[model samples]
Target: MPTILPALAAGALFGLGLIVSGMANPAKVLAFLDIAGEWDPSLAFVMGGAIPVAALGFALAKRRAAPLCAPAFSPPTKQGLDARLLGGAALFGIGWGLAGFCPGPALASFAFAGWKALLFVAAMLLGMAAFGRLSRPAPGPAPR
Candidate 1:
């Protein structure tokens, strides 16, 4: 219950920030990506603003033994990049370029962005499920 409330609060705050920063809007994101035609540098400001805050958060987190909301800091175990990582990143970029919404903003847009956001979210979820199933190791024979 305690963990849920804080997580909810954090998510709400993040969604609010996305909305305020125009990240939840596909048109705005597309415009930002449109370097050849009508590029909007406003989102750059948002990224710039976020980088320092994220850096400070990381620095603070490094000083702490455990996170305030969890038992311990659980960072990514994977260090070096591989084909899976590169392929995943490429797919993510392609999806973002085509749909103008990555997972975070897509989820935020899902509330008020109507049918398009709904479709995107649905497709994203399906893709995630498919990946999970395909990536799972095959079952082996039980030990005697």
Candidate 2:
């Protein structure tokens, strides 16, 4: 209950932020991507506003041993840029450019976006499931 409550609150706050940022609207995102056409620069501003807050959050998180609500901090273990990473990033960019909704905004769009949002979420989940099934990490050398 304790863990779930914090997760829910965070998700709600995130959804609210997405709504306020205009990220929940695919048209706005598409417009931002359309540099040759009617380009909208609001997303850039939103990201600019978020950068400092995110940097501060990361700094504060590093200072703390663990989150106020969590047991321990589990940061990314991998740092190298490999083929699989690059390929996945390319696909993510392609999808974002075509659909104008990444995971967070996509989820937020569900309420107002109707069937197109539902279809996108379904496809996104399918892609994720496929990736999970296909991208098993190579087995390392057996323990000595």
Candidate 3:
């Protein structure tokens, strides 16, 4: 199968899941975060539902010879926490507090006509691109 087909299918399914679980609503997420205020524990239930599904997928993948698309599985092996990681985490927390939407939920929230989500996604993409450039190696003289 084509790569685009799998990507599109995955995105469609993820969007549908977000819609069904009411994750596309920033109000719901904000309520969940507001523990001392009008607290909504519904997000916990969403996590509870997703965790098992994710665990099962992981288990199945481990048992498989190879992923259907690739010969080897690509997983992050980074274990050390560095300045870049900490900075990214701080930015993520600030963004979550200010906008009440992370990247996935922000994109999902777009389905519900979220203006903040559109802004958030645009900024997030820009941030990613900027970080990519910032992390690139500097040009230097090659060895003989």
Candidate 4:
């Protein structure tokens, strides 16, 4: 019933699912994105299978007072569409298409994909660090 136990179990299950669903394989993802080439629709099926489970989880979480292992739920605060949101989405899509990773599956793939996976993960972490620095508020008193 420890917090870390559930997290580790969930992460392992997710990695297994990614491997089984072929999401951990860059070739599979690249093929899915290559519409003009040897296109693959299997990734679509993988996503189709995940959406319902994710939606159900969200529905359940919304009804819960607090998570079983957490103090409270902290969902996204930004709801309005903005240039930052759009740009981030575009970056994510581009990264996914180019590297066959969107984080979860990337980390899951590390075991088999080796150094390529490490490079992608390194780049991802670097980008996240850069974004944190760049988006930080200026250290100054509030304007009157």
Q: Taking the tens digit of each residue's C-alpha lDDT, what string does model 1 give over 1-144?
A: 668998999899999999999988889989999999889988998899889998999998988899997898889999898999999999999999997898889889877988988899899999999999888886568857
Which is the better candidate, 1 or 3, if ranked by lDDT?
A: 1
lDDT of 4 by residue, 79-144 (tens): 889999999999899889987787998898888888988989999999999999888886579787
- Evaluate model 4: give its lDDT: 0.90
Q: TM-score ranking from best to worst? A: 1, 2, 4, 3
lDDT of 3 at 87: 89
Task: List TM-scores for all candidates, in order.
Answer: 0.92, 0.89, 0.84, 0.88
* Candidate that beats the other on TM-score, 2 or 3, i.e. the better one: 2
Candidate 3 CA-lDDT value = 0.83
| Global Cα lDDT for candidate 1 | 0.90
Instruction: Indicate the worst ten consecutive residues by lDDT in candidate 3.
Output: 108-117
Which of the two, 3 or 4, has more TM-score? 4
Q: What lDDT does each candidate get?
A: 0.90, 0.90, 0.83, 0.90
Top-TM-score structure, candidate number? 1
lDDT of 3 by residue, 48-75 (tens): 9999999999999998888887678888
Better of 3 and 4 by lDDT: 4
Task: Tell me the number of clashing residue pairs for each predicted model.
Answer: 0, 0, 0, 0
Clash pairs, candidate 2, are none
lDDT of 1 at 24: 86
Cα error of candidate 1 at position 62, Å: 1.7
lDDT of 2 by residue, 18-63 (tens): 9999988989999999999989999998899889988998998988
